[model samples]
Target: MMLLIKNAEVYAPEYVGRKDVLVCGEKIECIADEIDRLPVACHILNGKGLKLVPGLIDQHVHVTGGGGEGGFHTRTPELQLSELISSGITTVVGLLGTDGTTRSVENLYAKTAALNEEGVTAYMLTGAYGYPSPTITGAADKDVIFIESVLGMKLAISDHRSPHVTIEELIQIASKIRVAGMLSRKPGILVLHMGDARSGLTPVIEAIERSSVPIRTFRPTHVNRNADLLEAGYEFVGKGGYIDFTCGMEGQPSPGECIVEARRRGLAKELMTVSSDGHGSWSNYAQDGTLLEIGVSKVDSMLQELQKMVKELSVPLEEALLYFTSNVAEAMDIGNRKGHIREGADADMILLDADLNLDTVIAKGQVMMEDKRIKKFGTYEHSK
Candidate 1:
């Protein structure tokens, strides 16, 4: 398939105003000010002064749909393809959060592969909320090194709900992932899941300073969950680490505030990224060892955060879009085919109107949505 999007305000991070993008067979063939003429059988999309961005990549999501806190029946179902496409997410890094017992690594792997097979880009982390993580290969290093769909290891760190490994144990886990990632040529990262834990990232900070491991190996998420956590994240960034702020559920500290606060405190912009923990469970666990309440993550929060940055805070649209798109691609080490809009890259891009509302979404050269209506609905939804 050939697609020509014209008269679009383009930002592949840096601005190329009123440009054109040409996609043919899942690769961007050309990007420029205009392609004056078209070949036979060309599909032309009138950008209509809309903004074209690199497709959003949610690096941390429960693609298999995590839950199970309440009971066996409460385990969230696996995520559908349209749920991601409708939200303008082209690539997702699936993880098992808080329910690795019921949700195995096998299911996470299969779900990721299913999404990829169905024509969306997907990858997963090996570990979950446990100390000794469940892996398909029984070893974290082997999973990252041998498994193509497995990119890194994720653990719930600093949370009371977490297994709470010591600094030495954390370093040991980090070392294995780092070595395996080096051998496998993948990210081999430790994607830490931060909660409302009061102890903060002190353990992570101490380990990085004391160990031989590089700071880049640790990628912390949910920094915006609390003020102190956000502060810890900023300090981590200052020491040349990457931080991920979740586009968490509404009524939390807004993602916009975290971004602005980080900048206000003089943190490097590239050290930050944003993700939607879509379909993952969010719970307030009581001290008495019970889930007090629970909520499911909405896929739309990724787009909502982007809109808030551009419209509410007056942040430059290009700068804000990077967190959800390019920055994430870079963080996961998949920039070549996933993040940017360029030649030889996957055709994962979103078309938005002047107000930053998602108008069209294309994944892997397939138009999954147009004008905010999903061209591809779930299997059961379409059956009806």
Candidate 2:
């Protein structure tokens, strides 16, 4: 149904003043100081004191369940649609991590489809945690170029659990993703999982030095796992590469602190993004590399971090929202369509109360949540 929202203090992720927004079908029709009566049936919402901002885009998630690190019994459960919508995430990028053996890229693909059908935009990477990673079409490049939902390849580097593949192997995969992205007009990013090894980002530097693949082709995650790595991430961004900081980290500075430090260091915030690693397993390891504790991640961490940036660190809401919205959308090659609030953009927005809590979530013109309740759920979330 078309929607007409009146008196919203809009933040297109850039502060557009209080105005009326008209939605036609699944896209935003127009935004103006005043929108006259529509010619068709429409759902009207009064937004007199609400903040209407573009719905969040969470770049990293383990939608099909990401953990098996401690054994089969320790693997996490599949993500529920309510978890995402209630937490204000309107889009997600799902991928497998260490347990790619039992969990295939096929599982990630199926879960992506399920989330899209449940009223959110979902996409996924096609590989995970190993050299010669698994792909839907038997090759990362083929899957990226041929499959609609497959965006790029994922692999674990600089981690003990990783395959420890040679630099040559890394080059081969990166080359395929770069070429496939060029052919398909997609971002074809190489989403590297950063582990807590002492080498930090040396592997990424070696890969860039050994070959000519553009630095933008690489998207390293978990860059804030440690102070040294976070500093390396700043350097990476300075060199024109993109990196993502994981939220919900334990015993470390909050994502707000990291962003503040980045600003103080004069790092390019435009190339940085934040991800929740929702539904993945986060392990607490002893120096001997023994797992001391295992816990699951939550999607709410992403939203909480955004609020902290604005409320605690005094970051402007527009700049704070960009890291989670436009920055991520641009990295996926879908920036114009997914992240901002503009004419012809997807009508994915959230309504926030005066205190900045989520009051409503609308994805592609459909209400997924309102008044702090889940209005939609995944296929199984509502059923047995």
Q: How does each model score on TM-score?
A: 0.96, 0.98
Q: Extract clashing residue pairs from model 1.
A: none
Best by lDDT: 2
Q: Can you list the residue pairs that collide in candidate 2?
A: none
Tens-place lDDT per residue, model 1, 1-384, is 999998888878667788889999899999988786775677888996788888889898898878788887777777888888878898988999888887889999998888887778999999899989989998989999989999999899888769999999999999999999999989889999987778888989889878999999999888888888878888889999999888874566777778888888888888799888888878876677677887788888989899999888888988998788888888878888888887889999999988788899989998888878888765555673
In model 2, how large is the Cα lDDT of residue 157? 84
Candidate 2 lDDT over residue span 29-50, tens digit each:
9999999867887888888999
Stretches of candidate 1 off by over 4 Å are 249-251, 287-290, 378-381
Q: Which residue segments of model 2 deviate by more than 4 Å?
A: none
**Candidate 2 TM-score versus the reference:** 0.98
